[model samples]
Target: MLLEATDIHKTFQEGRETVHVLNGVTLSLARGEIVSLEGPSGSGKTTLLSIVGCILTPTSGRVVIEQHGVNAQHQGELARVRRQYIGFVFQQFNLFPALTALENIEYALNIKGVKGAAAQREAQRVLVAVGLAERLHFLPRDLSGGQKQRVAVARALAGNSPLILADEPTANLDSVTGGQVLEMFRALAKQENRGLLIVTHDPKVRAVADRVLKIEDGRLI
Candidate 1:
């Protein structure tokens, strides 16, 4: 399995009342499969993604990646592992405004200690792969929403991580553009053999997923 969560639970205490975000949530995703976490606002979809990505520690239970449990790793070690193993795409493009498309993707490689001529070559290839070869020199403001999203995809693809965690990836695009992005994801999963977990409420995206899961009131529905 690429990602696994075993009875994961988390809660927050607010004065006299406690807010439980995830209640015994358990799921597993295999390689080359696209799983959509379908839910409404306040359904804990983002909460679950954070927990799976190791951004937040669960209050109870455990998360396992590649069959290894998360509870045993130290904070710093776990974070490093997360960075090396997972990629993320958010609703917003989140690109650095000043950086060109090529520079944006290169930054991710630089963080992993890949730099100089080699970094540029890798970034160039990724940008081309994402259909932005001509727009490599363009800044964020110069690109459209769909182009920005493609750049984000290139950045995520640059790392070649085993698991991709995307929160509302289609929220910012028109339906046609969103469909194109979804198709790109599907091609990546099939051709690259990675796992993609997207948290979204769009019914159109539901059909693209290999499996559809709904969460309501902090539990699987």
Candidate 2:
């Protein structure tokens, strides 16, 4: 399994009350598989994605990636796991406005400790993979919504992470562009053998996934 999350639960203390987000949610993703997580608003979709992406520590339960059990309490270890095993894509492109498409990917690789000429090569390779080769030097401002999202995808793929976690990746694009992006995701999982867990509310996205899982009231159903 590329990713396995078992009995995941998250609770937040809000003043005097406790807000229970995820309750014993269990799921797994295998290599070359695309899983879509669907849920309503405030149904803990993003919260679960955050925990799986290693940005937030779960209140309980375990997350294992590539056979290594993650130590959520160890910040350093969490960072290492995130850098070495997981890539994240968000609803917003989240590209630096001043950076070109290639530069944006290069920056992501730099965070993974890849820099200089090696970073440049990997950045170019992934941009081409996402069909953004012609827009390599275009700044975010110069690119369309789909192009910017493609750059974000390339950034996520730059380090060759085994698992990709995407939260509402197509939320900001039109139907045509969203379909194109979904196809690219399918190619990445099917051809590149990357595991993808996409959190989305769109039925079209669920239709494209190899398996569609729904969450309600913090539990997977």
- In terms of TM-score, the best-performing candidate is 2
Displacement of the residue 76 alpha carbon in candidate 1, Å: 1.3
lDDT of 2 by residue, 166-219 (tens): 989999999999999999878876787899999998888976799999999999
Best by lDDT: 2
Candidate 1 residue 117 C-alpha distance from true site, Å: 2.9
RMSD of each: 1.5, 0.8
lDDT of each: 0.87, 0.92
Model 1: worst 10 consecutive residues (lDDT sum): 72-81
Model 1, clash count? 0
| Backbone clash pairs in model 2 (N, Cα, C under 3 Å; residues 3+ apart or in different chains), count | 0
Candidate 1 per-residue lDDT, tens place, 1-221, comes to 88889898989898999999999999999988999999989999999999898888889878888776786347885777576777788899899999999999899888866799988998998789889999999999999999999999888777677888888998999999999988987787678888999999888778789999999988988
Clashes (backbone N, CA, C under 3 Å), per candidate, total: 0, 0
**Model 2 RMSD in angstroms:** 0.8
